[model samples]
Target: MTFSAFLWMTFGIFGTLAIFSFLYKDNPFYKFAEHLVVGVSAGYFVIILWHNGLTPNLFQRLADGDWYFLFLNSSKPWYLIPAILGAMMWTRFSAQYAWLSRWPMAMYIGIATGIAVPLEMANRINKQLFAMMEPIDFANFFGTQGFDLLDPTSGLSQLIVFVGAMCALIYFYFSKAHEGVFGRVATVGIYTLMIGFGASFGYTVMARISLFINRIQAIEAWRATGFDESNPEYHGGFPAVFWVILLGVVAYAIVEIYQHRNRPPQSEEPSA
Candidate 1:
């Protein structure tokens, strides 16, 4: 294999094994992997923000005025206002002048909220209400073709959705006391919510499992091919790095067992 590919593969295998070692016990390997991930992610974000965000969006725009159609220009000196506001955020690091940072933060929050609220209302709330307001067509229920209750996207499914949503909303209506029929409907709502949560959890677990399987498949492919683009079917079996890590873990476990066996026990102290 090429030197660069081999080096990358080694690092990948070692990082994966180190992370998985946490299942055995909290150890230096797990800590190292965790810290490495955090550090790398933070560093990468900083680099991306500098190169993609700060440079092109702010500094370059200020330096070189943007002219559109040779008649309209937008990159005026006023562009420095946002840059100044962004710089004001760093004032939070100062002990005495930390309050100065709040101006920029407040501006950011206000602008973001102003932009997001209308979009959220239109996309989420309005759309959900419209979906729940589906027409109850009796003709479709008793048409020439018999109704299929098992069809998930049928009128029956829509009715169930509407009922579930209304019940859940009623359960959250704290103004009215949940007694008699209200209590029963609220109980059904709670069960519906629990089923929804369980399904969501199962989906999340399956997604994670799929990701894990994909990574394993990639590793197995690399092991079989030896990461050598020159030789498509090298048939190297497992990488040497994987074997080294496996042996190291086994050795560490053996040493830990030996240490636990030979170590002296603590004597009990007298009760006060």
Candidate 2:
């Protein structure tokens, strides 16, 4: 293996093991891995935002204007408003001018909320209402079978969805007391809600399991390159790096254990 590739693999193996070490207990290795990832991601995203966001949208547009004119000659002079607001956010670092930062923050939130509310209403409320209003195809409900509730597009499935939605809505209606028929419908609503939640939780757990499997696969891939010197992919440095890290960790653990065992115990004062 090339030296560069070997170095990358070594770092990968160390990082993977370091993160996994958290399962045993919190340690310097895990902290190092976590901080390294956070620091790298922060720096990476800063550069990405500068290049993809500010450089093109703001800087490039004002590039043609003279500095003396404050970029007023630029075609999109209005962009300066947002640029100034962004700059104003830095006032948060100043003790006296910290209040200035709130203006930009408020503006950001106000604009964001104004844009978000309508979109959310359209997506979550309007679309769902439309979906429930759709006519069920009872003629082809079974789709060549006696029952096909599993098919989302089937009439039976759509009918169940409509009924469950109504029941769930009724459960949230606090005006009428839940008793008799209303209580039974509300109970059905509880079942529907639990089923939805369980399905979502199951999907999330499966996703996490898939990620763990991927990590194991990566480790296996690295190990598949046999340790034999005769193998083309084999590198002496790979095994050397692994052993060095492993021994270092083991030695540190031994030192800690020895110190803990040999150290004098502290005496407590008599209770008042």
Candidate 3:
């Protein structure tokens, strides 16, 4: 492999191993990886926002100097408002004028909430209401003439969903005390909620597992580039670097264990 590609691959391998090393215990490797990720992500997003957001939408629109875009004579003078507000956010660094930052923050929240509320109502509330209101097709209950229990669009699935939603809503009714038939329905509602939560949790776990698998695949791919002198991807120096890093990590772990074993224990202080 090219030297640049090898260097990047080595970094990626080290980062993957460093993250997995957390299973052993919280150590310097994990901390370094974590901090490196956080630092790089922060800087990357800042550059992205500046270039993709501010540069195009604000700076470019107020081009041709136009009194440095401060005299309200630019083609899109309205862009100056957001730019000034963005600049005002920097006032947070100064104790004397820190309160000035609140104006921009409050305006941003107000505008965001105004935009989000209607979209959320339409997507989450209205769409769900419409779905529940639709008639269940019993003819296609078994999924187009076959016994497909997993088909969410089936009549049986729709009925169960309707009943579960109603029962779940009833369970939240504090005006009436739960007893007899009411209590039983509420219990069913709780079970349905548990099932939903469990399914969601399982899906999240599977996503994490998929991510782990991808990382493993990357490591495997890196290792597949064997040290064959005749091969185009051969790199004799990388294997040595990899071994050095591995040995250094092993040595660090051994030292940490030794220190913990020989360290003196602290005595508890007497109560006043």
Query: In candidate 3, which residue ranges exceed 4 Å CA deviation?
Result: 66-71, 94-99, 226-231, 265-272
Error of 1 at 60 (Å): 1.5
C-alpha TM-scores of all predictions: 0.81, 0.86, 0.87
Encode model 2's per-residue lDDT on 18-70: one tens digit a residue: 99899999988899999999999999999999999999999999898878999
How many clashes does the backbone of model 2 have? 0
Name the regions of candidate 1 deviating beyond 4 angstroms.
64-75, 142-153, 175-177, 227-251, 268-272
Q: Candidate 3's error at 142, in angstroms?
A: 3.3
| Candidates 1 and 3, the one with greater TM-score | 3
Alpha carbon lDDT of each predicted model? 0.78, 0.87, 0.87
**Tens digits of per-residue lDDT for model 3, 12-77:** 999999999899889888999999999999999999999999889888988845675464887678
- For candidate 1, write residues 1-272 as lDDT tens digits: 56557657767867877888898898888899999999999999999999999988767766655445321254556767887898899999999989989999999999999999999999999998998998855555533357776554566767878898888888898887899999899888898888799999999999999988977986776666664545665535435655776788899889989999999986698657
Show pairs that collide, candidate 2.
none
In the order shown, the candidates' Cα RMSDs to the true structure are 5.0, 2.7, 2.7
Query: What TM-score does candidate 3 reach?
Result: 0.87
